[model samples]
Target chain A: MISSFQKLTIAFTVLAVFTGANSLHAQQFRPAPNAHYPNHALMPPGHVGSQMLLRGGPIPGYFQPTQVRCPQGGKIAVANEGKFVAGQPSTLNVGLLIGSPYRFKITEIPGLPGTELFPTVELLDRLHPPAGLETRFPIPIHLTAQELRMAAEGMFITRVIYLEDPTNPVVVQDDANRQRFFDVRFNEDPLRVADQLGRPMAILRMGSKQPRMDRQTGRFMFSSPPVRTIMPVKQSNVPEDQLQRAIISTPSIGRLR
Target chain B: MSKTMKTSSRSYLVLSVFLASMMGCITPGTTSSGPLEKQSFENIPRPNQPASLTVSDANSKPIHRASPAAHQQRLPAGVATQQGPATLPPQAYTGPNAGIPYPAPWTPPGILGPFPEDEYVYQGGDAYQLTNVAQDFSIDNLDEEDTIAHYHTLDGKIEIERTNRIPIYAPRFASIRRIDGLNQYRHQDHVYAVDSPLALDGTAQNIGQEQVKQHVSTQRNIGTRASSLYRENQKLRDMAHQVASTEDSQMLKPQVGDLLNTKVNIKNSQEAQLSIQQQTALAQSDEETVKEYAYDLLPYKILANNRIQTNYHYEIADGNSRLDIKKVASKQDALPGELLEFTITFKNTGDKAIGNVTIVDHLSRRLAYVEDSQNCTVESEFFVNPTGKDSAILRWEIIEPMNVGQSAQVTFKCRVR
Candidate 1:
C-alpha cells in the first residue's frame, strides 16, 4: 500500500543507520600506534635491552708498532726524572727526521699476575715536528697512583711499548729503509729494567691472517693471528735538556742494524 | 421519544464510570489531562520549598514568630549543620614505656694514651764523647809483670807497659774519664807483647810451616777464579726462587745486567743482599723468588689501632610507619631516546612493626618504561593512562613487614629523553 518513492526513502534511511553504526564500531576496535599495551610481543628475550643501547663497540686493536728513529747526531732517551714512585710522570724523547708525520701511542702489556698499567698517551702534533733541525718529541707518560704503587711494591713488572702509529699511510722507498726504522728499541730484557722505569719495547706486527666467522651465528670462529715480531730496542739514558742537542750533534742516525 | 433519551443518558453515565476506573488502574497518581495544564497544577506549591502557609481553626491559638534580630543572631547553615568537636578516644597502652620519648644514647670518642717513645742507646763507644782536658797526668816506672805499681810523672803523660801474658791471665784495670758531667771508662785500649819463637822438634816445625804456606797459596788461587762464578750462580738461584714464588711467567726473560744497579727488590729476603746485577740475572731466570724478594723490599706501612666502632639502635613510634625509598640511576643524564636503568631501594629505618608497603611511581611522559623490567617478588604492573600518551604508572605491593636495617630493591629500565 506504500508509495514507491516513500518506500525507497525508508530503505535508504535504514541502510545509512546500519552502515554508520558498523563504521563507528570498527573505528573503536582499531589499535592506535605508539600506544603502550600490556602485551610484550616485541621485547627482546632475557629482558636484555638492545645491544646498541647498552655497551659500546668491541675492543680496539691497540697493539701496533711503527718505526721510530733518532735524528742525526741525537739518541732517543726515556728517562724518569723523579723517583719511580706511584703517581710519578716519566719523559720519553724520540728523535725523528724533520717534516716527518708521526703518531705515537703507549700500550700497557700485562705482566705477571696482578701487574697492570693503565695505557694512556698524549698525542702530539704530527704536522710540525719541533722547530729546530734537532727534532725530538718529549712525550710525558703518567702512571696511575695504584700502578706506580704496585710497581714499587714489586707486585708485577709493567711492560709498555713506545709504538709508532703503524696505521699511518706513509710511503717508504724500500724494505731496507723500513727495516732500519723499525729496528728494536730498548733491547734489554724488560724484567731486568727498573720497575719504576717501565720496560719499553716495540710490538711489531708482521702481517694479519684471514679470520674465519661462523655462518649462522655471525660470531668469530677463529682468533686473530698472533704477532711474531717483538723486537726490543735500546733506549739511551740522556738528560732531558741535552737530549735535543745530542740528536743534532750525532752524524749518523741511531738505528739498530 | 422520552424513554429513548433516558436510556442513552444512563448508558453514557455507565461508560464514564467505567472509563474513570480504567484510567486509575492504568496509571496510579496521574491524571489524563493536557500537559501544560498538568504542569501548571504541579508547580503551584513546590514540594522542595518549606511549607509557609499557616493553618488556623476557629479555636486555634495565635501563631508566634521570631523577630528579625533573633534571626540575624542565629548561626550560619554550615555551622549549624556541623557536629561538635570530637573527643579523642583514649589509646590502650601496649607496653610500659608506650608514648614516651626515649633519649638517644651518647657516645664519646675513644681516649688513647700517648704513643710509647722508643728508648735509644748509643752503640758506638767513646767516639761520640767530647773531651776537654785542662791538665796532663802521667805515670812512670811501670813494670810489665807487676800487677801493682805507683809512679808520679809530668802532667798529661801516660806510660804503656806490654806483657807477654795470655788474655785469661792478664790483670784487669779500669781507667775512668769525666765526659758530659758523667764518669765513663776508657778501658778499650790494651796492648800485649808478642811471644818469642817456640822451641820445637826441628823436622816437625819445618814441615808444619811448609803445609800452612801451601794451603794459603791454594786458597788464594781458587778464590780469584771461582768467586765470580759462585756469585753468578747464587744470583741466578735467587732470581729463580723469586719467579717461582710470584708465579708470574711474564717476568721470565733473558738476563740483562745494564739496569741491574737500578733494580730494587720490593721484598728483600734473607738472601736479598746479593748485588743488583746478580739479582737481575737471577730474576730473569727465576720469577717467584725474585717477586717475593721484591715484595719484601717494598716500603709498606703498618696500620694499627685505626678502627672505629659504632652502635645503632632501632626504635618504633606509635601509629607511624617508617619505610623509606631511595631512587638511584646508573647514569643521570642520557641522550634523547637513550635507555637508562633505574633502581628503587626500600629500607625500613625503624623497628620491625612497619607493615606491608605499596609503591607507586608515575612515569614521565617523555619516558617509555620497558616491559618486565620490574625485579621484585610482588604484585607489580605498568598501567598506561587512557587519555595521555607516553604516560604510565608503575605499581608494586610488598606484603611482608620490613624489619630494622632491612632493605629491598626493585629495578626497571626506560628510554630517557
Candidate 2:
C-alpha cells in the first residue's frame, strides 16, 4: 500500500545508483596486460570513451560485437585542434575502432574545385595514431594548404571497411585483386553489406574544431563533433556471375587501384 | 768851354746811347710782323715726345717761338694729335733762362707733378696676384725692367695691390705630351673603390654574401605572399559574386555583404602585397649591385697600400639603462631572449667630407624592437612589414656632413623573441 509518489522516488534513486555504478565500473575497467593493443601507451591520461549508445542492439548480417561503432554514435571523429595555422605543417586525426587489416579512402566532394586529396599512402601510415584513444587506431592525415582548405570546405571518407582477410599484405599495392575480393563478398557496392546491417559505414562534414563548455565545471574544452551519417546503401539484386564481373571491372577499392 | 755848353753836349751823348740800347732790346731775335712771338722755340720738345728726352735736354737748347699747328703738322704719319686747333703759349720762354726750354704740359712729369713715385698693381682676381708697375720714375735713370713690366707697359696696367692669393687661381695651361718617355699632364680615369674599413674587413665579404642571401630569401617570401594573397582574393571575389547573384533568404544577405566586404579588403591588401613584392625585387637588385661593387674593388688590397682606411667600428652593449651594460653578440649573430643594444661608431677617414651617410639594418623574424630605443640625434625610421610577418626594417640617416677624422655613433636596442 505504498503511495505512487514514494514509489516513483524510490525507483528514481535506484536508477541513479545503477547508472553511477555502471559509470564507475566503466572507468575502472582496464584491458589485460597481455592484450595485443597496449592501452596505456596508446591513450592519453584521463581519456574517456564517447558517451553515445547505438540505437539497434546489433547489426544483422555482421559479426556480433562488430568491434566497430556506427557513425551516428560518435565512433569516429576528425579534429584539427591547435593544428590549423597557415603555411605550417598540420595533421588531421581520424579516430576509428582498433581493427587491423582496415582500409579507408578519402575522396573530394565532387564539384568542389579547390578540394585536393594527397595520395592515400601518405595519410595512412602505421605510426602516429589519432589522439585520445586507447582501443582505437588512427589514420594520421597530413594536410597541405590546399587540402586544409578543402577540408574546411567539406570533404569525407567515402568508404571505411575491415577486411576479413586481405590477399595482399599491403592493401595499397596490387589493389585490383583486393577490389575484386571486396566486390564478391560485400556486393558490387562496398557498403551493401553495411546497408543490410542497417548502420552507417561512411562519414562526411569535416569542419574546424569547436570548443565545448562543461555545464557543471564552467570550463571550455575542444572536441570534434560526431561524424555525419549516411542512409544504408541500397541493395542491388543481381546474379553471382554479374557480381563477379562487376568486381573485376571495378577500377579501385579504397583508392587502392 | 762854358758850363751850359758842356752840360748840353753830355745830355745829347747820354740820350744817343740810351736810344741805341733800346733798339738792341726790341729787335733781339727775328721780329715777326704778325701777333706771334718774335723768338725761336726749337729747343722745346713736343708734348707727345718721351719725357726722358725732355728731362735730359732741359739745359741744352734755347727757347724758340714755334707755332703749335706747325709743330703738329711736322709729326710723323700715323701719330695722333689732340683734336681741334692748337693755340700758342702766352710766354714760351719760361724756364731758368730766357733761352732754356719749357716743359710740355702733357708729359708724365708735368701731369704727375715734378716727380712720380714707383707703384705696383695687381691685374687679376682676388684669388691671384699679377703685379705690374703702373707708374715708375727714377732720378738716377738706372732702373731695370723685367719682361713682366715690358708686357704690362705694352698692355694697360691695373692700379690695385693684392695679397693672399690661392695657387689654383694662377694662370696655368697644361697639355698632354710625351716627356722623358712618360705621359705628362695625363691620368687614368678614377673609379669608385670600396675603401671603408668595414668594407675591407674579412668579415665584410661574408656580410655582403649574407645580406645578398637574406635579400633573395626576403624577395622570395614577398613573392610567395603576394601570389597566395592574389589567389585568395580572387577566390573571395568569385564567392562574393556568386552569393550576390543568388536569391537567398534575408538572413543570408548580411553574410553576403560580409563576404563582399571581405573580398574588397582582400583585394585592397593584395595591392599592398604586390607593391611590397616589387619594392623587394628592386631592393634585391640594388643589393646585387652593391655586392658586385664591393667584391670587385677589393678594399683590402687598397688598405694594404695605405690608400684607404677607416676608423669605423661598431659596439654592441645590452642593458636596461645607460650605466648598466653587458656585452651581446658580435657581428651578425644573436641568441634568443637577448636584450641587445647596437651602437655603430661611424668615422670618416678620407681627406674630404662625407655626406648623405645612411645605415640600414634589417631585423630578423626572431627579434623585436625595444620601445623608444631609437636615437634622437639622427633621422631614423622603423618600418614593420605590411604582410604581418615578424620582420622589420631600421634606417638611420646622418644629415649633417662629416669631415675627415670625424666620428659619430648611433645606438638602438632590440629584444630577441
Candidate 3:
C-alpha cells in the first residue's frame, strides 16, 4: 500500500511540473529596458521637451487643443512657469503642442476630498482632426479613481495615451464610465507597447512627488509653456456612459474628426 | 533507497527540466531591448518614400505636412504627409540635347575619314581645314539686312531701316569675301580620285608641292589675324580694369552729353533694345559726373564682388526611383540661448547608384552653427560658408557613391540667437 501511494504521488508531481513549464513557455515575450532607459529618470519635470520643440517655429496642428478629463471630478489647474493657477473645476481644455511636455495639478478630489495630485503629460505626437472641429476631437485623458489612489500611496504610475487603431482594436465591453486599459508587468515599457498597438498621443506620469520650494527647482518641476485656452466642450444630453462610448468609438470609424 | 526518497528524486528531475524551458520564454529578442527615444519613429513612414519629402525631428517625430490629401487619413496628427515650407519643387531638367536624340543615327565618324587607324598619315590637313574653314559667303546668312531703307520717322526725321531682301541685286563687297573652303576641298577630292594616274609624273608631283605651299601660306595669315584680335581684346580689358580701379578723385568727370550720347541695343529684339536703353539712361543719370564709373559698374556687378563657391553632387536614376532628401528640426521654436538640432535624411531609392551625394542647408540668421556637433551615418566631407551675415550655408558631401536602396543620415546642432 505504501509503495503504491509513493508512485501515485511522484506521477502527480511530474504532471504538475510539466504543466507549469508549458504555461511559462506560452507567455508573451517582453523586451528588456535598454541603456537609454535610465535617461527617463534624469529628465526634469515640466514641458521642457515641448518648450524646445517651439524653436522650429509653429507647425500645423502642433498646439492641438486637448481635454484633460478627471472622471471623478476635481479642480484642474495648469502651471505657468512653475506657478500653479486657480484651476477650473472638473475638466480643463487647453491647447498643447505636439512633442511638448505639460504639467498640471488636480485638486479637491470628489471622493478623496481635499487631496491634490500633480501629473505631467507629454504630448509626444498630435492628431489631424477636422478643420473647424479641432476642439471636438480633443484627446480625452481619463484620470480614474483607482489610478489616483495608487498614486496617492506613493506609487509611480505611467499611462500611455494612444489612438486606438481601427483595424486592430482591443475588444472590450466598456461603457462610458469605464475606459478599458490593461496593465503590463513592471519590467515592460507601456510606451513602446502602446506605440506598437497604435499612435501614442501622450505619455502621462502620475506620482506623489511635490514641487520644491526653490524657484529654479520649481521652474523645472512646473514649466510655463504658452497655452491657448479653448472653450469647454458642451455637455451632451445623452447619458454620460453612452456619450463616452460614442466619443471614443466615433474616432475609430471611417471619418475621424 | 526508500519509496518516498525515490519519488522526491523523480520530482526534482522533472522540475529541473521545466525550469530550463521556462527560462527560454522569459528572455525576449534584442528588438525590444532599447530606449523609447531611439526607436520612436512615429512620423517616419515604413520603408521610407511614403512622400517625396518628410521633415522629422531628432526623435523622428515629423513636424511638417507631407502630402495633405493622400495622407490625411493615414498619417498622425501634427506630422502631416506633404512637403514642408522650406522644400521647393525640383527644378526642371531638359538636358542640352532636348528633343534631339543622342548620337543621331546619321552622325558620320566625326569628320575623321576612312583609314583613321593610320596615325602616320597627314590627317591634320583635312581635320584642321574642317574647323578653320571659312563659312559660306552667302547673302542669306547675313546677320544684318542687306538693303537699308530710308523712311520718315513720326518726327519727320529720316530713319534708316535695314530690311531683308532677295539679294537679286549686287551684293556688298564685304559680304562676298571668299568661296566655301569645305566645298572646294570636296570638289577637288572628287576630281583627283577619278583622274589620278597609277604613277604620278614629276609635273604632277610639282603641282602637289605648289598646292601644299599655298595651304601653308593661308594658315599663317589666319593665325596672324587671330593674334591681332587677342591683342585688341587684351587692351580693352586693361583699360576697363584701370577705370574700375581708379580713385574717385582721379576719375574724369563727363559732360551731360557724354552720358546721353551712349547708344545701347545695337543688336537683338526691340524689347531688349528698349530695356537696355532704359538701363543705360538710368546708369548714366545716376553717375552723370563720371562716365567710366557707370561703364565699369555693370560689368563689376556681373562679375559679383561677393565670392561664390560652387560644388557639384552627381546623381543617376535607373528610370524608376530618384534621390530624395529632407530636413527636420528638433525644435520648431526655441529660446534665444537654447541649442537646437537639425537632421537631414537622404536616400537613393532607385535600382542604380547615386554618385557623390551632397546636401546643402541654409541656416537662418538667428542660428549659430555649433562646432563639432555634426554626425553622419556615412563618411562625408563637411563645409560651411560663414561669410553670409543673414544666413550660413552648410554643405555635406558624401564621398562614396550610394548604391541602390542605400540611405544615409546627417545631423548637426545650432544655437538660436
Q: In candidate 3 chain A, where is summed lDDT lowest over 10 consecutive residues?
A: A248-257
Model 1 DockQ (Cα-based): 0.00
- What ordering of candidates by TM-score runs from best to worst? 3, 1, 2
Per-residue lDDT over B1-417 for candidate 2, one digit per residue giving the tens place of the 0 to 100 score: 699999999998888656644542343221122222323344445454322222212222222212234435544666665455332232332221222221221223235422111111111122212333334411111111100101111122222212121111011000010111112112211111322332334332343345447768877766666777788899999999886656433333333434223322245755565445434544676555444434423543464685335454545332211111111222232222346565544555445454544443444333456767866344534333321333455545556655656665556776643
My TM-score estimates for the predictions, one after another, are 0.16, 0.15, 0.30
- What's the lDDT for all of these models? 0.31, 0.31, 0.49
Tell me what fraction of the real C-alpha contacts between chains A and B each candidate also makes. 0.00, 0.00, 0.00
TM-score of 2: 0.15
Which candidate's TM-score is highest? 3
lDDT tens digits by residue: candidate 1, A1-257? 89999999999899768655555544444333332423121122112112212333211211122233322222222211111122211323332211121222222322323433222121111111112211121222222233333433433322222322111111111111111111111222221221112212222111111224455642231111111122333344443333222111211212111
Query: What is the Cα-based lDDT of residue B56 in candidate 3?
Result: 25
lDDT by residue (tens digit), candidate 3, B1-417: 699999999998788656644532232210111243233333333332333233222113221222233334444565534453222211111221111111111213454322111111110011211111112311121111111212222232232222111111100000000111334446656755744442233223444345557888988887776788899999999998886554333233242334323433333454464455546655665455255446544654655654444544545322543565555667433333457776666676655565645554544444567988999999988887663234456667678877878888988987644
Deviation of model 3 at B1, angstroms: 99
Root-mean-square deviation per candidate: 51.1, 59.7, 42.3
Backbone N/Cα/C clashes per model: 43, 5, 23
Ranking by lDDT: 3, 1, 2
